[model samples]
Every structure is written in C-alpha cells, then in structure tokens.
Target: MKRALLLLIFAMPASLSLAACAAAQQTQAPSLAKRPIEGRFDVAPPAIVIPPPGPLPSDLAGRLARWEADAASGQQAFAAERDATAALVAAAAGAPVASERWVVAQQAISRLTAARAPLSGALADIDRLYIERTVDEAVDGLPDIYALRDRIAEMESAQDAILQALSAALPGQ
Candidate 1:
C-alpha cells in the first residue's frame, strides 16, 4: 500500500504536466493553420493604370497663360511694396515724431493690399477652370483629372498663405 501511495505522488505531477502540454499544443495548432487560411482569402486587387490626359483647349490654355502673367506681375508688385515699406520703417524710426515716412509706409501697405485683389481673382478663375475640367473628365470616367486638380489646389493654397502673411505683417496690425 505504501509503495502504491509513493507511486501515485510522483505520477500525479507527471500526468498533470502532460495534460498541460497537450492543452498548449491544441491552442497553438489553430494559430499555425490560421495563416494559410487567411492568405488564401485575402488576395489583393490588381493595380489600376490611368492614362495620360489630353492638352487643354486653346482658350483655356490662353486663360492660364494670362493668369500666370498676372501672378508674376502681382509678385513683383508685392516685392516692391515690401522693399519700400522696409525702407520707410527704417527711416521713420530715426525721424522725429509724426513723420511723413510713417504715412508713406502705410500707403505702401495699402498698395500691397490692393495688389492682392487681382491676384486673388486670377487664382479663383484658375481654380474654377481646373475644377470644371476635372468634373468633365470625371463624367467621362477618367482618373487623370486628379493631378491637375491637386496642382491647382496646391497653387491656390500657397498664394493664399502668402497673402495672409502679408496682411499679418503689415505695419500697425
């Protein structure tokens, strides 16, 4: 009887350890098979290939050319105003109270603000043109419009940021 009791004590731990190993194996078996099942059903779709877009119509191209010219001139005008304002501010700092240079600085700033109006208008026209073109292409079931549309949006955002910065940097708020 004592021999049997001694055998039971040692065998019980071995049997428990064996059962634990089997349970671990059963859980891990599903994970090992899961990868193959997932791979079989999770096939990726084929890549889409978009064709190149055609050139803009002559009239639209002309409009874009004119707007580009306007944008260039507007940049030149803004730079001129910025240089004049800087000079006037420097002069006003050394001059006596209530200097005329300060007034000229204000005028330069006003001119800068005025110059942005036509630029903003030209940008809007460009945006409208691109949007219309994009929509037209979409109706025809084409994907090439995205590039032009994105370009226009990027340009509009950059120009708008410049105008905002100029407005903020103007002397006296």
Candidate 2:
C-alpha cells in the first residue's frame, strides 16, 4: 500500500507539470503588429536626365531614324490587332466563345509576336547607343525609347492573355 501511494505521489506532479506546459502553449501568440519590419518597403526609381540633343554622326542619325520608323509601324499594327480582337469579343458577347474566337485569338497572338520584333530591335539599338555614347549624347531621345519599350511590354502581356485563352479553348494540338 505504501509503494502504490508513493508511485501516485511522484506521477501526479509530473502530469501536473505537463498540463501546465500545455496550458502555457494555449495562450495567444504575440500580435503581428508588435513585430518590427525587417526590410525596406519603398524604393525610389533612378533619375534619368534627358539632356539636349547633340549633333549625331550620319550613320547613327540614319539608324535612329530607321528605328523610329519601324517602331511607328509596329505600333500601328499592334493597335490594329487590338481593335480587331476587341471587335471579335464584342461580336461574340452573347454566345459561348466558339473555335472561331480561338482562331481570332491565335491570329492576334501571331500579329503581336510579329509587331514586337521591331520595337525590341529599337530598344536594343538604344541600349547599344547608350553604351557607346557619352551620357549627354545618349539622353536626347531616352524617353521616346523607353516609351516604346514599355508599350511593347504591355502588348506582350495582352498577347499572353490571348494565348492562354487559345490554349484553354483548344487544348492539345
């Protein structure tokens, strides 16, 4: 009888200790707002000073002019494709989107892909010129160059959405 009583006395405190530990864990976690932020939240964009246009070498001047022309044409084509896609969507508003809509979407994707090349080429030219020329010499048309790059990227995203629709509409070949 004494041995059993002794065993219960020792086991009771150990079980009570475990219960207290579990109760401590059941307390609410620390609030997230109390924690300090670890890293930066806001970063400012770099400044790009566009200087006055300097006299250009004949070859570079001619190349820039050609690039401008190509960019203009590509922009026009992209606009046209966008309009066509919008028209197709408007026309099919009531009906379930048909395979014909997928065809139109595929065509739009192809046109967007074709139109991107020239703008990409123009951006590459700007990058090359930036590297080759002095800062002042390179800054004259920087805004226009960046605008074309941004426009192309936006169009690429639009094309990607259309491509996704096409794949979903006509899965596998």
Candidate 3:
C-alpha cells in the first residue's frame, strides 16, 4: 500500500506538466490567412479589355463622329465597296458572266439609292430625339412619323441585302 502511494505521487506531477504543455499550445494556436488572394495557388492574371469599334477607312472618320450620321455613312461605304468590287470583277480574267455581275452591281446601286431617303429620315428622327430628349415627345403630331419609321425599316433591309450579296460573291466555300 505504501509503494502504490509513492508511484501515484511521482506520476501526478508528470501528468500535470503534460496537461499544462497542451493548454499552452492551445492558447498560442496560429491564425489562418484572412484573404484567399494572398495565397493564389491556382489563379491567373486578369484579361485585356478591347475598345468599341472605330472608323475602318481613314476617310470614314466623319461618318463615325456623330451617331445619327452612321446610317448615311454606312450607306456610302456600301456603295463604295460595291463599286470597287464590281471593278475588280470586270477586270478579272475568265470570271463567268461579267455582264451578270454588272447587273447585280446596278441592283446594289439601286438598293443603296432607295435606302438613302429612309436613312435621311432616320437621321431626322435622331435630330428630333436630340431636340426633344425623348422619342415619345418627338413623335407628337410629327408631320411624317410614318416616313421616319419607314426609313429605319429600309435601312435594316438594305443592310441585310448588301450583306447577302457580299456573302454570295465571296470566294468559294
């Protein structure tokens, strides 16, 4: 019984010392990294931003300057490109049916001409919008509101036809 008491007395101090050590470690626990960005194990850098389109042709500066002018300018660009393309076709050797190509070119010219007045009408709408700040207000008792609407429609249709013809003319599939 005396020997057992002595063994327990020795073991008690060692056990207490171990408990104190564990408690100290718990108190001094290291803090976690607050932000995930600090340790970016798998992250890459940000991508570049591209600007909105600018004038394509050097002379196209005037066209892009004012927003309302865009349609009229676009029409001019279409005609110019069509003429240049037609000239190329006329000059090209053994291009099947140059006469047919020229006829198509005339049709494009007619379409562009037809598109011009409507485009001008759209510009008028823009001008009205500019003056009045709202299309609702601008459209009140307007002399030719229908004509302005017609022009916007014409511009859309003409733009589509131009694209379609160009797509057809582009070099083989």
Candidate 4:
C-alpha cells in the first residue's frame, strides 16, 4: 500500500506536467502574416555632418608654448646631468661596490632619472589634449599637439639612451 501511494504521488506531478506541456503545444502562436505593418524599413538613416574645427584658444596656445619651453629646458638639464652621470659612472666603473665613488655615481643616476619628469609630464599633457580634442571632434590644434608630442618623445628616447649607457657603465649594475 505504501509503495502504491508513493507511485501515485510521483505519477500525479508527472501527469500534470505532461498535460501542461501538451496544452501549451496545442495553443497556436499569432501568425506574423496577420500582424499589421509598422514603419517603412526601406529608407536609409540620415548622414551625420561634423563641422570643421576653428583656431585654438589663446590660453591653450600659451600653455603649449610654456610646455615646449619647459621641455626644451628639461632636455638641456637632462643633457647636463647625463654628461655628469656618465663621468661619474666611468670613474666608478672599477671602484668597489661599497666605495664612495660608486655611491655618488648611483645617486647621480637617480638624479638623471628624476630629470625625465618634465618631459614625461609634457607628453602626458599633450596626450590628454589630443584625446580631449579628438573626443570633442575638434581638429584645429591637433597638428601642433602631435608635433610637440613627437619632439618630446624623441627627447625622452635620447635621454633614455644616455641613462642606459651610464647605467651599463656602472660597476655591479
């Protein structure tokens, strides 16, 4: 009797589920042919027209000038530091790791690394301006911005080469 009751309980749900599925299958979905048409699908979307960019603002132009000047100064300072660091590295090349000369050379290398900050900052600012103008669809100052960025990048690359040479010259590096 208990077995029959268990079978009945299980069969009841199974039967109900089967019946529900059958009923669902028997119900017909509304035909697409019978539905009313909406808007016309044949026409193409309108073209978007972007206006040409005008002249750069005076303040922005001044900022670019200042950045360029700062980059040039930084490059000069970097060149001086690189030369000094190279001399120190050469002097320390044969010195003991714990020697004062070696320590001073390491400090000079650190200073050389620090000198790159201005160039990097200028590059970052130029990149930000480029992105902002690009996003705003403004193309006026992009040429100048790009030229400055390239110049800064070249300066940075030259600085990096000097630093690498000096670092490689140092003992125990």
Best by TM-score: 4
Q: Which 10-residue window in model 4 sums to the lowest lDDT?
A: 33-42
Q: TM-scores across all candidates? A: 0.51, 0.42, 0.30, 0.65
**After superposing candidate 1, which stretches have Cα over 4 Å from the reference?**
1-44, 94-101, 135-172
Q: Is candidate 1 or candidate 3 better by TM-score?
A: 1
lDDT, each prediction: 0.61, 0.62, 0.54, 0.85
Q: Which residue pairs overlap in candidate 1's backbone?
A: none
RMSD of 3: 16.0
**Which prediction has the highest lDDT against the true structure?**
4
RMSD of each: 6.8, 13.2, 16.0, 5.8
Clash count in backbone of candidate 1: 0
Alpha-carbon deviation at 138 in model 1, angstroms: 5.3
lDDT of 4: 0.85
Could you give me the TM-score of model 2 versus the true structure? 0.42
Q: Which stretches of candidate 3 lie over 4 Å from their true place?
A: 1-70, 87-143, 171-173
Per-residue alpha-carbon lDDT of model 4 for 1-173, expressed as tens digits? 99999999999999999999999999997777633455456578899897655677676899899789888888877877887888888899999886999999999999988887888788788889889989997788777788888998898888888888888888788
Q: How far out, in Å, is residue 135 in model 2? A: 10
* lDDT pick, better of 1 and 2: 2
Q: Which ten residues in a row have the lowest lDDT in candidate 3?
A: 55-64
Which ranges in model 2 have alpha carbons more than 4 Å from their true place? 1-54, 90-98, 134-173
